[model samples]
Target: MKQPLLDMRGIVKSFSGVRALNGVSIQLEKGEVLSVCGENGSGKSTLMKVLSGVWPFASYEGEIFFEGSQVKASSIRDTEVLGIVIIHQELALVKELSVLENIFLGNELGSFARLDDEAMYRRTSELLARVKLDVLPDTLVRDLGVGQQQLVEIAKALNKNVKLLILDEPTSSLTSTEIEILLNIVSELKAQGIACIYISHKLDEVLSLSDWVAVIRDGEHIATKAAADLTQNDIIGMMVGRQLDELFPREVHDIGEVILRVSHATAMQAGASRPQVDDVSFKLHQGEILGIAGLIGSGRTELMQCLYGCYDGQYSVNIELEGKEKAIRSQRTALQAGIAMVPEDRKRHGIVPIMSVGRNITLSVLDNYKALFGAIDEDKESQDIDDYIARLKVKTASADLAIKNLSGGNQQKAIIAKCLLTHPKILILDEPTRGIDVGAKYEIYKLMFALVKEGVSIIMVSSELPEVIGISDRVLVMHEGKLKGDFGYRGLTQEIIMNCAIKEGA
Candidate 1:
């Protein structure tokens, strides 16, 4: 039999006396696609870092055998030289640099004496073509969308002569079309005898793209089986160590009166030919969960931004809040008028990475804890923080820890706590569970139900069709900045929502 391309045995890694990976073992055959599935903080990314030499050889105790030889890599460069490349969850490309420059940034394509621009451009073109991307090499990285940027990251990996490609959450930000394209590229790479290790929280993608499925839970390997023999529930059961009876734990709540009404709302980008959000109108009720569904650039986010008073474009919004007309011009105005939003890109817009957990939670209502002498009341702040932490079940060692140290779900909880502190009548969440694990997603869904029961209205914008149909009281589909259809969840299906989103009309 042919030797396996990679073999890792008894890998043990720890941080500050906490074991991240314990007695984990995995093997990969030539050209095989192995998927790593687990919940948040399950040590999936840590194992990949160990394999790719990000944790280095001396930092962890493990034996990695590649091509019948034991390998000890001290750095990422060493692993890359051995044809083991990792594209991280957070992209590593410099946005200011051109595609050609970002691809060959550290690993330039020329001799020591002279630079070879022509050779690098040619190689970049070929790599882009291999990934089926048609963008020019000179295009700036910042100019591309998240899905396009992901394709560029893959093209960059291909330029490294990658024999073993490791992708961590590559499709987290991609649309359906982009995900299909990326999966096709992975298949092509497999056909060319390139091994891949795909780490993702999206179980459906893992089941579809992998030849071998490996489940890890709490830093331990639970099971590794053939993809054909396993189902999505089987994988989820292994990852969370229990059967998830349902993906959406929806609870019934009594939806009250119409609290918010917007009529003829239009938003236009500066110097643009046409309005991005054109004559959009919607109504949101008290104690209701209203879901907004659309494609990537369907103006769903733009409309939300305009409503939240953060849109940079010129917008005219005629809104009635509880039967009273109001003019909201800025985020401060929106917040003061009982509105709060949790943005889509959590890492970039949600939390202050350097701030402590307690600080992030109480950031919105700091004035409420101020004393007459102008001194901030630490005891009150701490009490409120502790209360919410327990209420939301945020997993953390202490409130003093940096918010960034928490997982995606925990960070989201912190942001939600911040919004709730403002005593907002209306809550807006954009892609609230974008990068969260399955377990965390359930918690958030339950939290939404609890909020609505307390008479708080919610407007959620999400790309996941199942989620939109599962928990939403009603769904509004947008197609090219226009309201295509409004659906009730009773008889709603993904097919109907998608048809409304893609159907052509003025």
Candidate 2:
């Protein structure tokens, strides 16, 4: 019986007519790591936002007790002053700024009218060392990869003298080594009596690190139990309110003839230390879901980019479609060849945030929805948009709503629907379910099964082992810009795949 460090009672949050969190309650003890589990739109992030003052005092109805005192935070500054900090899924670092500058961007070292660069840099270097990123303090954020950028975000949080840290999908983009370092840091923090609220879809890490677990379903608190008392299946059951029959609905299909093939693919970028893709060669056949598994910056993205012709270079990658060679030098060519790519960052590259759902859904197939002599057919577009919205089960009032109005999971479904309209033969999905919730992940997996049944080939790159193992018919492990091993569904296990990902002798 240690006294609870923080207690949230009767939390109720709403948006318009929809309830995001309804009378949910939970508690955190000093030095305790409590994991909040829920699918997308389940109110986990919303709860964290409330705690971190992203929602502020008057925005929601709740009583938050911190250190035996009722606290009302007016803003993020107030929350930080109470020693509570949050690292969001979409990092807050400025790419153009150096590591030290980004870390101390708002919190400068000197008194009100002066700047102290030396003190800031020295403190930043110490923080970086604590996180075990020995890179130079002057290195710009854009110069670092996604994994390193994640560490920078954590370091930024540590700089705030955080006592209660809320991390939303902190390891989504980290490498195996980086993940271990972060886990170690959490252990150290706990020893010093710092509490943590880790929100992640990565169940293995959740079970390993969390002392207690709380599950939320559809904005309702389901249960809170000790880590040892609950299993992964129990967490899933609590989150979705039902037992999931299978994690991945993988089906066996006859392998068809080679539909897409890449040979000797190479990309050269300035000052990258190594080629982004080094003579990568692989063949993708019809009715196949080829999964490319790797850590961040291991060249999976670059390989796909090269195949889609997004890089600038004298690359010599031979492509064979229907047993004949074809030149693909641009994105237009890739799309014309019936290849559709669902990029990694949906907000940045996948969709137009401000546009209507109808417009976003019909953007890819607009050519087909046009009348004679370049006239756009509004009726046809509306009908097709309606069909996709229903098909994807997008939770929206109507197709006329702004794309930004939907939740992250629904936004992802909209992007997938947009790609489906292209009716491509080969589909490339990069971290398709990165920030989405469990129910949304199930929907995406079902969609994939339906697509594969229709003879479309899929190339998925994911950091989640369950996703890679569950959905892929075959897994290709990439390490240090090269394919290290390949495993079929029948022969693959998480342990073996991880071993392949980090082979002997580096």
lDDT of 2 by residue, 64-86 (tens): 98888887998889989889989
Stretches of model 1 off by over 4 angstroms after superposition = none
The candidate that wins on TM-score is: 1
Q: What lDDT does candidate 1 reach at residue 454? A: 96
Model 1 residue 169 distance off true place after TM-score fit, in angstroms: 0.8
Worst 10 residues of 2 by lDDT: 307-316
lDDT agreement of model 1 with the native: 0.89
The C-alpha TM-scores of every prediction are 0.95, 0.92
What is the per-residue lDDT of model 1 for residues 244-296, given as tens digits with 9 covering 90 to 100? 89989889899999999988888998888778788999999999999999999
What local lDDT does model 2 show for residue 66? Answer: 88
